[model samples]
Structures are given as structure tokens and as C-alpha cells.
Target: MTTLLSVQDLAVARGLRTLEGVSFALAEGQAIILRGPNGLGKTTLLRTLAGLQPVAAGQVVHEPSALAYAGHADGLKSALSVTENLRFWAGVFGRTEVGPAIERMNLSNLAARPAHMLSAGQKRRLGLARLLVTGRKVWLLDEPTVSLDTQSVALFAGVLRDHLGAGGAALIATHIDLGLPEGRILDLTPFRADPARKAPRGDGPVGFNEAFA
Candidate 1:
């Protein structure tokens, strides 16, 4: 299969701390689960790959416009209804249709409800649904199952399977098993940056680590 994303000796920073020597390639139809204990920089790495943050070192190679990222935030407009939110994102990506995405995410029932009225899990589902209208080939998901119950988790897994089956790729940072039989795991423990190496001071404001701290 064709490689959709390639990471070469990537070193991602969370404030002054860095996680280095990480490398991986995600091919079409493949899903790679990012595994490591808390504070291991899984989210940091995903953010760097998503271009939300600057990379500390090394390279991430992919075609422009190939990536779609979903983090903890739903990235929704509170005033918009579920369908309207999807429609907005679809329009951003130059897509004209969102009916399939609504149906796929099981959001059809809640389509007319404003985002502010949805519960946490419902909001999370709405967040994940944005990925469908992106039309991007590679997905970078961080803790995608948060707040989702057993049934919704299964629902997400099925949608993920369909994405992979249809020639897409994903790099997910998640704790729970997504029940993907073909999924591969990349443990970040071995790739942790050397604590002894002095982290370069940043000239700008403190980054993700300090904010969370």
C-alpha cells in the first residue's frame, strides 16, 4: 500500500521537554495506535504532526492537505445545530454534502439540535463526525473515545474500520482498545528524549506542557 504519512526521527517538544527519536510510516488502509503512559508526549507528537505546533527536530513528510486532525475539543460552533456544524466544515473543505457523515456518526437523530445543548459524549461524537467531511486521506486523532459509552465506542470503531477499508490511514492516541484486529501499536516509552540533554529555551510564551501544568 502507498504511504500516507512518514515520520523520520521526529522529535516533538512539549514546552522545554522533548520526546525524540520517534519514527514511523502510515500507509493507506493502516491504523497505528499510539501507546504510552501519561506525560509521555503522545498528544505532543500528534500536535506536531498535525502542524499545530512546531517540531523540535527531524521531519514529517506528507502531501499538503492530506491530514485531518481531531483533538479533545469538539471544534464546533456552539450556536450551530449538529447538521449546520457539519455543513460548515464540509463547506470549508469544499464538500457540499454532510448527510452521509451525519448518518455514519449516528448523529441523524440529533441533527437539528444546537451544539451547546448536547451532552459531553454527544459533543464528542459531533467532533469526530467532522473528520468524515474533511475528505482527507490521513487522520490524526487524540483520545477520540473520550466520554463515549460502550455502544458509541463500538460505533466509532465501526466507522474507523470503514475509513481504513476505504483506503484511509489513522494515527490515534487512545487508551482503550478500538478492536481493530489489524491495527499496530507504537509505544513511545523507548523513544523518550534524553532527560539529560538540555532543552533549548524558547523565546516565545510557554507551550503546551507549561499550560497544562
Candidate 2:
């Protein structure tokens, strides 16, 4: 399979602490589930991979336009309707259609409704749907199943399966079983930075955030 993303000896920073000695490669048609306890820097690692934050060490190799990130925030426009929101993202990705994405997320009935009126789960689904319109081969998702119900989670699994089938890849940070038997798990516990060791200057602090500590 074609390699979609490559990370070598990567170190990700979250505030003062850093997650070091991390490395992984994601290939087309594959899925990797990030596993670790809370405060293990999973979010920081994903943010680093997604280019939302700077890497403290190592490298991430991939096409600039190949990545699509979905974090805790839905990244939505509350004033915009579901269809309008998708259209906006599609346009941003140089696409003009949102029909398929809407249908795939089972948001057809709610397409015309304003985003602010949707439930938490609905918003999460919509956020995930944005991935479809991106046309990006590598998806970097952080807790994608946060507010999804069982059925919605199943629906998302189907969509993900389809994406992989079409040569797309996903690196997801999640705790729940996404029903993907083929998906591999990468535990981050082993990569946690030592609290006593001091990271290099400008590389942030040496220990995890107090909230996680």
C-alpha cells in the first residue's frame, strides 16, 4: 500500500511537557487507533501531526494538502445550515458538491437546519462529514466518536471503511471500539515524556500538564 503519512522519532509538545520517541507511518487504506490514558499527550501528538502545533523534535512527512484534521471542536459555523456549512468546506477544498457528504452522514433531513440548532451528537457527525468533502487521503481525527450514539458510531465506521476502501487512511485518537477489525492500535503510554527530565529550551517543559498529572 502507498504510504500516506510518515512520522519518524517525532516529539510532540503540550504546554511544558513533551511526548518523545514517537514514530509511526500510515499507509493508504489503513487505520491506526491511538491508545493511552488521559494526559498521555495523545491530543498533543495528533495536533502535532495535523500541523496545528509545532513539533518539538523529529519529522512528519506527507503532502501538504493530503491531511484533514478533526479535533475536539466541531469547526462549524453556527449561523450556517448543515448544507451551507458543507458547501463552504467543499469550496475550500476546491470542490463544489456537498450532496454525497450530506447523505453519507445521514444529515439529509437536517441539511437545511442551522448548525446551532443541532444536538451535540449531530454537530459531531457534521464535523466528521467535513472530512468527506476534504478529498484528503490522510485523516487526523481526535476523539471522533465523542458525542456519537451507537448507531451513529456504526454509521461512521461504515463511512471510514468506505474511505479506506477508496485508498484513504486515518490516524484516529479515540477510546471506544470503532468496530474496525483491521485497524491497528498504537499505545502512547510508552512514549510519555519523563517528568524529571528537562526538555531542551524552547521545546517546552519536561512534565505533563498539571491537569493531566
Candidate 3:
């Protein structure tokens, strides 16, 4: 299987060094767990992978046309209605039929509601539903389980499993248990220990922000 994303000797620091020489390779159908304290650069790492943040050191090589990113903010336009939001994302990914994606994400009944009008968990589902439209081989998700009810979370887990089983790759930075049978791990606490290497703030109040483009 091909490596979807690779980081070698990865380091990111503005004032504090949150990750030092952190290296890993993510293959298709595989997932990795990144655990750490508050200040570590787990979010920064995902941003860098998505090419939203500049890498101070090391390298991230990714194949083009095989990337999609979702972060803690939900990234939906508040002014857009649910169907409109799905339409925009569908247009962006060039995907057909908002129907299948909506049904797959359990969002069929709420398609007409405006995003801001929805509850937190509903908003989260709206954000996640984009993944199905994305049609990307590699997914970068930051705290994907946040704001989801037990049932919705389980459904999202099933969705993720199906994505992986289809030869897709994912990197998730999460505190919630994923219930996945297998995943790799890299702790970020050690990197945050350095007082000088503080991480960035903004975009979701101390959480991962996987910005693409």
C-alpha cells in the first residue's frame, strides 16, 4: 500500500517547540492517534499536513487530489441553509447527489435548517457530512467526535470505518475514544515540556484545526 502522508523529523515552533523529530508514515486504511497536553502542536501538525501552516523543519509529502480536511470549527457558512451548505460542499468536491451524503451522515431530515439554527451536535454532523462528498483518499480530522451524541458518534465511526475499508487513510487528533480496533500512536506531551516552544492559539479554543488551502 502507498503511504498517503509522511512526516520525517517534523518540528513546528513559534515560541515553543511542540513536536521534535516526530516522524511517521500513514498508509491507506490506517489511522493514527495523537495524544498530548494542552500546548502541544497536534493541531499545528494537522494544519501543516493540510498545507495551511508552514513547516519550520522536516517534510510532508502527499499525493495531489487525495486530500480532505475537517477541523473543530465545523467550517460551515452560518448564512447558508443546510441544503445550501451541502450544495456548496458538493460543488466544491464535484460530487453528485446531496441525497446519498445526507442519508449516509444521518442528516437527511435537517437539510432545510440553517446551520447556526442547529444544535451543536447537528452542526458537527453537517461538518462531517462533507467527508462523503470530498471523495478524497486521505482525510485529516481534528477532534472529529466532538459535539456528537452517542448514536451520531457511532454512525460517524461506522462512516470512518467504511472510508478506511475503501483504502482511504486518516489522521485524527482526539481525546474521545474512537473504538477502532487498531491505530498508531504518537504522544505530543514531551514536545510541549519546552517552555520556549509554545503553540499557536485561535480557531476552536485550544483544539486541532486542519486547514486545507
Candidate 4:
């Protein structure tokens, strides 16, 4: 696999330090489970990588087109139908169709239903389906299993495994087991209190290009 992203001395904060001195690399097709107690900056890191948050210091080298990042509470618009939301995401990511993303998330039957009409698990699936709209090689996810039932979670794991098999990389932060084959693990709590303050909390950071070792 080739290097997909590189992160060095990353840090995130929220008025106070959330985490610091973080460094890692990521390659294509690898998956790493990021573990940490609440408030260790796990979620913060994912958001920062997604470009949703600002970075304080350090370089995050990456192939620009090869990334997709998602976070918990990324609810679909309640008034919109599943297909509508998917269309919106596809447009945002410049994807042509929502076919594979919908199928992989098991959302075919509910495709026409309004977002608010769906159950918790179904909604989560809809949210995750957005990932498929991007032709990205790197995925940064936070609490990807928040509302998924056991079966749906299993299905998601299967899809995620396939994503890796296809030369994609994933960095997931979750309190639950993700069941990814050949997946590595990282505990973000050890570098917080913000222990090891290197960069500002709640900001910009780099993606890892060789983090799976």
C-alpha cells in the first residue's frame, strides 16, 4: 500500500487543552481503531482531519482527493428523504450517484422515506452511507457505531472491511469493537489532560501517511 496521509505533532483544544503531542501516519487500505476515554480528543482529531476544525501546528501531508471523514451526530436533514440527502452528499462530494453507498449501508428500502421517519439505526446507516459518495482512500470516523444495532453494525463492518480490501484506509474512533481484519489500535487518552501538549486543541493537524505499523 502507498502512503495516504501523514500527521505530525498534532494537538487539539477547546478553550482548554483536549490533547497534544499526537503523531502518526496512515497508508492506503489499512484500518486503525482509535481508543480513548471520553474527552481525550478522539472526536476532535477526526473533525480536525475532516477540515471541520482548525489546526494549530504541524503538517498533515495527504493526497487531497483521498479522504472522507465522519462524526457522530451527523444527522441527516429530518425533513428530507433518504434519497434527497444522498443526492445532497453526492453533489457535495462531486459523486455521480448514491448507488453503492446506499446498498452498502442497507438503505435501499428506506431510500424514499423522510429522514425523521427512520429509526435510530436506520438513520445512522443513512449518515454513514455518505462515505461512499467520495472516492477517497482515507476515512476518518468518530463513533461510527453510535446507533447501529448488532446486525447493522456487522453489516457496516463488512462494508468497511471491503473498503480496506480495495486499498482504502480508515481511522476510526469508537468505544465498540469494529471487527476489522488486520486492523491496528491506538489509545488517544494517554496523550491528554491535555497530556503532551504539542499543538493547540480543537484545530488543524496533519493526516498520517504511515500510521498502521
Best by TM-score: 1
Rank order (by lDDT, best first): 1, 2, 3, 4
lDDT values for all models: 0.87, 0.85, 0.79, 0.77
Rank by TM-score, highest first.
1, 2, 4, 3
The clash count of every prediction, one per candidate, is 0, 1, 7, 25
> Relative to the unseen true structure, what is the C-alpha lDDT of residue 58 in candidate 2, on a scale of 0 to 100?
91
Residues 1-213, model 1: lDDT tens digits: 899999999887765555898999999999999999998989888877887777788899998899988887888889999999999889988897899999998999999999999999999899899999999999899999999999999999999999999999999999899999769999999988887765556512334532100
Which candidate achieves the best lDDT against the true structure?
1
Q: Which segments of model 3 are wrong by more than 4 Å?
A: 191-213
List model 4 lDDT by residue over 1-213, tens digit each: 688888898766644567667888888778888987776778777776766667655667888677787776755789999989888878877877888788889889988899999998898889888888877778888888888899998998998898899888999998788777668988887767533444444444444421210
- Over the full model, what C-alpha lDDT does candidate 2 score relative to the true structure? 0.85
Model 3 scores what on Cα lDDT? Answer: 0.79
- TM-scores for candidates 1 onward, in order: 0.93, 0.92, 0.87, 0.88
Pick out the ten consecutive residues of candidate 4 with the lowest summed lDDT. Answer: 204-213
Q: By TM-score, is 2 or 4 better? A: 2
> Which wins on lDDT, candidate 2 or candidate 4?
2
User: What lDDT score is found at residue 37 in candidate 4?
Assistant: 78
> Per-residue alpha-carbon lDDT of model 3 for 73-113, expressed as tens digits?
88889989878888888888887667777898888788888
- Per-residue alpha-carbon lDDT of candidate 2 for residues 1-213, written as tens digits (9 for 90 to 100): 889999999877765655889988999899999999988888888777776666888989998799888878887889999999999888888988889999999999999999999999999999899989988998888888889999999999999999998999999898889888659999988888877655456654334221110
**Angstrom error at residue 6, model 4:** 0.9
Off by over 4 Å in 2: 198-213
